[model samples]
Target: MIRRHDVTPAQFAALAAGYGGPETIEALARAQLSKHLLLIKFIAEAWVGARAHRDAAVETLTRAQAAAPAEVAELLGSPLVGAWAADCTRRLRGGLRAEIPLDAECNHLSAIAAAAAALAGVEARLEVPSFGGRVAVPGFGLTKLDGAAVATVACGRVTVAGAAQWLAPRTLSATSHGRSIRVTLDDVDPYRGGHHVPPTGRLTSVDGWQAVFAEAWDLLATHAPARADELAAGLRTLIPLQQVDSHSARSATIRDAFGAFGLTMPSRATDLAVTLVHEFQHSKLSGLLDVTRLSDPGATELHFAPWRIDPRPVSGLLQGVYAFLGIADLWRRLLPVVAEAPQEYAVVREQVRWGLTSLEGSGALTEAGRRFTSGMRAVFDDMAADRVPPELVRRAERKLRGTHDAWQRRHQTTDSPARP
Candidate 1:
């Protein structure tokens, strides 16, 4: 269906900014720092939509993607494009409609609207594909029939078992470049057993942790509601994770605790803040991307997003990721300075260096290399400019510089074991 619409400057920027070379969601976030919430909503919807109508949407978008640029350009003014984008995102990130029965007609409306907005001068040849297969949720444990996800808008309305059983409503969305996506789980029980774990080693009471959360909240709340909301909303996602334990994660570099099985309590503010921000970024970032026309390629043969039945070239997703690295790395550099056990500065440096190695290998980093450096430096600059506290910023910067220099010396020495 073709409908008339108009694209805005902001939407145009989002389309351009979402590419991260390899880190789509992170890049998308950096591109829309000014409109973080919008970015979040966009990415989340895209991911979940994709999850819901994996094959149909992918097939639709692939056909749409293959359309002549002249026609694709027309989609900018077509209301159908936005509707499609919204639907695919839902399938990709939200639990698949097969199990949830989401109201994906919502996407038809959205794709049309966004198409009108994102493709202004271009007329898009749009097609709404029919969903007709099993679907899976990207991160959540759920599934549904082709149309069931949209049908069960009320599916997540209530939970029967423990807090773990509680379900939430959310629309997955992301920027066109896939910088990141957001999943807004609805009807959340803020106080739940999932978030209620016995404070572990080094943890005294919830009161102590609450004080830290309060301070972080105070700092976050002082900013835009968008910032506060993302901060709060991001935290809410972690509540159900076996990894609320993730908050206690400490890392010299990768914060692997959250990524794998690790149990430890946070002993430093920087560690706590960085861990929260990183996981938050991951949760949100993962929401917006179109990983495949199926569920985790690692886990299933099913596509999560609606896409054509073919190898969908995610050529741009990684491009988007490089941009995300610039942002995530900056935050990592700015986290805090604490000489806690296993959280040594040297360890962090090796981690950063190891990370840079990945960037170096990616080649996009070569083009975006300068931008990456500038972004890293910006962390300290923000602290000096008072966007962050001087004390926290200063220590973090020192740690980073120390790490960088050590990394350099190691490379100069034996190319092994990273210099001491």
Candidate 2:
């Protein structure tokens, strides 16, 4: 479990009053911060004790989730409780942390009982559940596929049966027993991150993602003729080659970001596409290290997207993030053949068509141009020679030529000595 601090009673009462609204978020956060926080709050509030806190506290938590990600509903203490509150609102039997990290990168899961042991200042290891590729064991028939832990949180019991919601670019899943709840999430962004994706089909060694990539790319090519240029530009940046996933573009959160990547899609397809793009971008960027930084981490950053602020001025930082999103968006929009390649999987075909219709016109993503234009130019040199439109290709060139004038106008560094 990721360790954290505690919360105070006064803090709990102060923030608990505002449970489910954006009034405080709107006022406290910048426009960019506010937009992403809305999504964070939506998912976070759905997790266990979120409902107990005041709207302000939840809003504060949401903001922290987005900007101060290092501190989500961590072990911060709230005096009103016996021990400390993981969150101001999440008052467990004794206000303790329930999450435990299972893997090196903190991508695995462990039970709460174990977490409490460590939290009680006992420093014990928790026994976590296991499911690797839903294998057919000696006695068992079938099981879950292999993947990292996608959801982990603490709370009083919530819904009986775990309700899975894949709203797109956003998702919410909460399972409660009696007094506690475990709500896992992705996000719904004005310009938000798509996260916590489930497997669409499978990506084992044999019937792996590589095959899925070629087929999905071909299918998407037919519908998104306008995106072809963007697609080609993105493809040229990859290192080894693009490898798409089985049941390509079938993840839950990706559904909402279909339009942003320039794809006309249904819900399910969009979801899968969104995730595939993210993974694919990661793969490709690794291939293109010499290419540019316009491309960033598709896996680490996008895999668990927190929330995105939507302020116009903050677009500069947003631009850095959008560059990667643009690549994933393209990947999602372009992969549709997982369904048709019956030669590989028949059910996948049906699922693809079904999802495309479900996630229609969810949202359009702006090209995070400011940051990537340079990166794009650097990596796509092949396109640079002829693939890129002349005017577009000349962009960085012009900027470089006018560097002196630009520096005089915008450089903020001071040359004068400081006076005490």
Candidate 3:
């Protein structure tokens, strides 16, 4: 059965303000679950309509749901599953062929069912997709069977013929001031791609990743407890990407895959914390956009975003504004404790201020989007008022001007105006 999710006016305002509490995060999660459920239903119906092979995976999933409703629901709510379902539906809708055989793609449902059955302690036999001799049980670990494609789940154990290796799921944790954050280091799922980078299959060792994640969590919990609580509630899966350099990492969030971050390993805990907060803000806005109409579906206008090299659409501009708003708040809270916070806050405050200006002038925003931007403006106004050293403030202004000039020069030949 499909469930209806709603955001009250007060909840909407709080979320738009960029500091929605944990409860709002939970509500957004529920809304995402509902969306995933609808997508799964669409996939099933489309497959049947196409006269595709009928697999027993759906039946197995139904059995698991009956036996352990809560556990099964949690498994189905996984972001990887959401990604798979969305991709399959899109391919089917567009009459596009999947990279894998349709039957193999259909078997992904079986893998999900097998994982659910194992969680529920139900015996089940199913043939799941195998990628390069690896079978990934969604929401769990991966089992390598060299050439095997079928998986058997019995007594809460997953096994396949000629199994040669097993990699348990990795998770990292950190706590401070009676608050803790735990997240799965998901490096094994085949469908974990589309996070803006190819998934790095499995890590040789998670020790380094664990240390950095723990330090990052501690930083958030100690200084930004509210954001920490939000992380504990909303951040679930971290998809590791290949590091770009010793000091830099690339990270992105998928609109369809809420609660999952695809990121390279950061050398510093501060970088990791900021990345988590920034990506999670994107996730929150994505979820809100799902339930509400924030922008006109037909409106098309590009605007200058100080953070990006090219002009961005109104929707993209709004996303940047919201993300930097969170970063600005993070640095604002860390100002007294961390020496670099003032400089960091000044930089993001300027970027966000520029983005908000672009968004406010955009003709693409719906009434709800306008209200949301206003809430963000109120938050930014507070952060902008924070006293930074005169030198740092001057530095930020100079940087903004330099970026704007560079952007204008780059887009001068284009039809769209360089500034909003």
Give per-candidate clash totals.
Answer: 126, 60, 0
Tens digits of lDDT, candidate 3, 298-358: 7768888888997788889889999999999898988888878989998888888888987
Least lDDT summed over 10 consecutive residues: which range in candidate 3?
A: 46-55
Per-prediction TM-score to the true structure, in the order listed: 0.32, 0.22, 0.95
User: Candidate 3, TM-score vs. the true structure?
Assistant: 0.95
Give the alpha carbon lDDT tens digit for every residue of 188-207 in model 2: 21112223432222112322
Which model, 1 or 2, shows the larger lDDT? Answer: 1
Q: What's the lDDT for all of these models? A: 0.32, 0.26, 0.82
- Output the lDDT of residue 334, model 1: 37
Q: Where does candidate 3 stray beyond 4 Å?
A: 48-54, 95-98, 146-148, 245-247, 413-420
Candidate 1 global lDDT: 0.32
lDDT of 1 by residue, 107-223 (tens): 343233223222322222222222343221212222223332321212222111111231232332222221232332211211111122421222123444444544444433332
What's the residue-level lDDT of 160 in candidate 2?
12
Choose the strongest candidate by TM-score: 3
Ranking by lDDT: 3, 1, 2
Better of 2 and 3 by TM-score: 3
Regions of candidate 1 where Cα sits further than 4 Å from its true position: 1-212, 215-237, 243-271, 281-343, 364-370, 377-420
